[model samples]
Target: MLTVYNLKMPHAVYGGENAMDNITAILKNHQAKRVALFTDGGILASGLFTLPEAAVKAAEAEYYVLSDIPPEPSYTAVQQIVDQFKENGADMIIAVGGGSVLDAAKLASVLVTDEYGVKELLDTPGRAKKCVPTILIPTTAGTGAEVTPNAIVAVPEKELKIGIVNENMIADYVILDARMVKNLPRPIAAATGVDALAHAIECYTSKKANPFSDTFALEALDLILNHILPACDDPEAMEAKNRMQIAAFYAGIAITASGTTAVHALSYPLGGKYHIAHGVSNAILLAPVMRFNAPVCEDRLAKAYDRCCHEAENRCQSDSEKAEWVIGKIEEIVRHLNIPTSLKEFGVPKEDLDGLVEAGMLVQRLLVNNMREVTPEDARNLYLEIL
Candidate 1:
C-alpha cells in the first residue's frame, strides 16, 4: 500500500536574475552576523563574490570568504575552514558556489562542536545533532546541494565516496540566483542538469516513493525535460537556467524525502573509484541502470520516457518503443555533452569492476534505497554489465 509523506526544503529559495539582491533581506530575517563565506576560487574570481561581499557589508557583518575548495573536496579540506571559523567566531555561514562548496560548509558546521576530528561525520555513518546554520547560494544548476539533506564527500584514506556523509547536514537557507549559473561551461551545464534529472527519476521510482515527493519529483522532471537543453544552448538566458536551477533544487528536496534508487546507487562506485565527477558518473550509468530496472518500473516510466524523448524519436507509440526512444535521447545528450559512455573510457579495467562493486556495497544508505532488494552480487552484475 502506498503511503503519504511530508516533503520540506530550506527556509527559502530565491531564483531568477538579480536574485542575490534579496540576500540582505534573507540574512536580516535570520539576523545573520559574523558570517564566514565559503566558496571555490573559480567563483571567487567569477564576480559573484561581489554580490555576497556587498551583502555582508550591507548587513554590517564581518564575513570573510574561504575559497580553497577543490573539484572533489575531502573532509580534511573542510577542517581547515572549520578551524578558521572557530577562531573567527562566525555565527552564520554563507556558502556561495557549486555543490562542492556548499557541502564543505555544511560539513564544517558539523565539526564546529565535534570532540573528535571533522572526519567523524564521514566515518561514523549516522546523524548529528550539532551543526551551525548555513545559507546556501548555488552557482550551478546541478548537485542541488542547497536543498539536499545529504552531502557527497570523498575521503582519501578510505578511498570511498561518503553518501551518508551526514544526514543532519541540511542547510538553513538556499538562494537559487540563476545569475550565478550564467558563466558555467556548456558541458558542465548539461552534465549537472542530467544529474538533476536522474535525481527526480530515481526517487520517483524508488521503494520509498511517496505521494508528496512524487509530486515534486514529477514536476521537477517535467521542467528539466523542457528547459535543460535551452539552458545549455544559451547560458545567458536566465529564464531557462532559472527553471532548470529551480528544478534541480526541487529535485533535491524530492529525493531527500523518497531517496534515489538504482541509478544513484550504481553511480556512486564510478565516482568514488574513478573520480569521474558525480554528474558524469550518473550520465554514464543512467541508461544501463534504467534498462536494468525496466522490468520493475516500465509501466510507470513509459510516460516519462516519451516526454523525455523528442518528436523525432517518440513516433513509436508503445511503452517499450518509448523506452528505446528514451535511451536514444539520453545517448544523444551524453554524446553531445562529451562525457564518456563506459567505465573503460575512465580506465577502469575488467579487474577494477569488483573493487568498484565492493566500494558500492559499503554505501548501504543509498544501496538499501534501491527499488528492489540488491545484493553485492547484484551490484557486481550491474557494474560488469556496464563494464
Candidate 2:
C-alpha cells in the first residue's frame, strides 16, 4: 500500500430504478442544448437507446446520434468519431452502451481541439483536456468506463490495446439503470460480469492497493461473486442484475484508485490481435493470472474470501486454504459462465505464443502493479496455460 494515494470519481452518480430518468435533469443542469449521443449499432438496434432518447427529448435538447463506434475500436476509429462530433458541433455528449462506446465518447469529449486528438493522446495523454461534459449510461455492468479516467483503444500497428489515462476524461455524470442491462444476452452478461469479478480481485491484490481501494474492491467482490451467476442465468433476476451493476461501478472505482495487474496486461493482446471482446479476453485470463499471483497475494486473497464467501459450509480456517478456495471459486465461476477458458477456442495458435508474450510484456503500466513481479518467462508461461 502506498503512503500517499488519491481517489477520483465522476462529479455525480445516480443509480437504481428509474435512474435513466435522471438524464433529463442532468441535461438541464448542464444547460446542454445540442447533445451528441454516442453508441454502437447493436445498442441502437436493441432499442436500448429509447429511454435515454426519450429523456433527451424531454429536456428539449436537440440530439444527434453517433452510433458508428466499433467494438474494441482502434485509436484512429476513435479519432473518426471525434471528428464527427466536432463536425456536429454538439456541446455535450451522452454515451449509452458498453465500454467501447463509453470510451469513444470520453475520447470525443476531450478531442474537440485541433491541437491534439486520440492518436496524439496515445503518446502524450496529458496533452488533452475535457472540452465538453459527458453523461455516461452503461448498458453493461462491467468496464466501469463511466467512472474511470482511462480510455482503452486498440493500436492496430502493434496489435495491442493501450489505455489512455487522463483525469480529465472521467465522466461528468453516470447513470446506472438496471433496466439498461435487464435483457442483455446471456453471453454478454456472463463475460462482462466476470470482467467485473477480475477487476475486484486484481485491484485488491495490486501492489498499489490501499485503504481507499480496498474499501470498494472488497465490497465489489462480495456483490459480484454472490450475484453474478443468478444475474446472468435468470432473465427475471432484477435484484441480482442491479447489484451486479453497482458492483461493476465499484470495481471501476477500484481501478481508478489502485489499478489492475497481469490479468489485464496479458489480456490486452488477445483483444487487440484477435478482435475478441475486452470482457471475454479478461474473463479468459482472470483465473490463470490470479493463480499465478496466489503465492505472493494469498493473504489478500484470503481477506477477499472472508468478505465474499459468507456461506457457512464453505469457510476455510487457514490463509492458504482460503486463498485456494478463492481461486477455485473463480475457476468455478468461469466454468459455469461457459466463458472460454482456453485460447484454443479463439483459434489462437501455439505459434503465436512468442508474439503474445512480447505484446503482453509491453503493458508494463499494468504489469508493474502486480504484487508478484511478472517477467518475460512468467508472461510466456501464463499465455501458454491458456493457449
Candidate 3:
C-alpha cells in the first residue's frame, strides 16, 4: 500500500426503485434546455431507452439521440461521436447503454474542445477538461464505466485498446437502476458479470491494494460470487440482478483506487486486434492470469475465499487450499456462465504469439500493478495456453 491513498467518486448516485426518475430532477437542477441522449441501436430497438426517454420528457427538456456508438469502438469512432455531440448544442448528456456507450459519452463530456480530440487525448490525457456534465446509466451489470475516470477505445493502427484516464471524465451523476439490466441477454450477462468478478479479484490482489480499495473489493467479491449465476441464469431474478449492478459499481470504485492487473493488461490486445468484446476477453484471461499470480497472492486469495465463500470456508485446511479453492471457484463460475475460456473459439491463430506478446507487454500501466511481475516470456506462455 502507498503511504498515502485517496478515493474519488461521482458527485451523486441514485439506485433502487424508480431510479430513473432522478434524471428529471437532475435535468431541472442543471437548468438544461437541451439534452443529448447517448446509446446504441440495440438499446433503442429493445425499448430499453423508454424509461430514460420518459424521464427526459418529464423534465420537459428537448433531447436528441446519438446512437452510432459501436461495441469495441476505435478512437476515431469516439471522435466522430464527440463531434456530433458538439454540433447538437446540448448542455447535458444522458448516456444509457453498455460500456461502449458510456465510455463514448464520458469521452464526449471531456472532448468538447476543438483544440484536442480523442486521438490527442491518447498522447496527453490531461489536456482535456470536462465541459458538459454527464448522467451515466449502465444497461449492463458490469463495466462500471459510469463511475470511472477512464475511457477505453481501440487504437486501430497499434492493434491495441488503450485507456484514456483523466479525473475530468468521471460522471457527474450515476443511476444504477436494476431495471436497465433486468432483461439482458444471457451471453451478455455472463460475459459482463465475469468482467466485474475480474475487477473485484484483481483490485484485491493488486500491488496498489489499500484500505479504501479493499473495503469495496471484498464486498463486491461477496456480492458477485454469490449472486452472479442467479442474476444471469434466471431472467426474473431481479434481486440478484440488483446486487450485481451494485457489485459492479463497487468493483469499479475499487479500480479507481487500486487498478486492475495482468488480466486486463493482456485482454486489451484481444479486443483491439481480434475485435473481441472487452468483457469476453477479460473472462477468457481471468483464470489463467490468476493461476499465474497464485504463488505471490495466495494470502490475498485466501482472504477473498473466506469473504466470498463464507458458508464453505471450513472446507479448506490451509491458506494454499483456500487460495486454490478461490481459483477453482472462479473457473467453476466461468464454466457455469458458459463464457469461453480460450482464444481458439475466436479464431486467434497460434502463430500470432509474438505479436500478441508485444502488444500485451505495452500495457505497462496495468502490468506494473500485478502483484507478481509479468515478463514478455510469461505473457507469451499465458497466451499460448489460451490458444
- In terms of lDDT, the best-performing candidate is 3
What C-alpha lDDT values do all the predictions have? 0.76, 0.92, 0.93
| Span of 10 residues, lowest total lDDT, candidate 3 | 306-315
TM-score between candidate 1 and the true structure: 0.92
**Using Cα atoms with residue i matched to residue i, what is each candidate's TM-score against the true structure?**
0.92, 0.99, 0.99
- Worst lDDT 10-window in candidate 2: 306-315
Q: Please give the TM-score that candidate 3 achieves against the real structure.
A: 0.99
Which parts of model 1 are misplaced by more than 4 Å? 1-4, 123-127, 165-167, 306-316
Predicted candidate 3, C-alpha RMSD: 0.9
lDDT ranking from best to worst? 3, 2, 1
Tens digit of per-residue lDDT, candidate 2, span 1-387: 877999988989998789999999988988889999999999988988999999999999999999999888999999999998999888889999999999999999988889888888989999888899999999998888899999999998999999999999999999999999999999999998898888999999999899999999999999998999999999999999999999999999999999999999999999899988888899889888988999999999989988888888956999999999988898899899988888887888899999999999999999999999999999999998888
Superposed by TM-score, candidate 3 places the C-alpha of residue 295 at a distance from the truth, in angstroms, of: 0.5
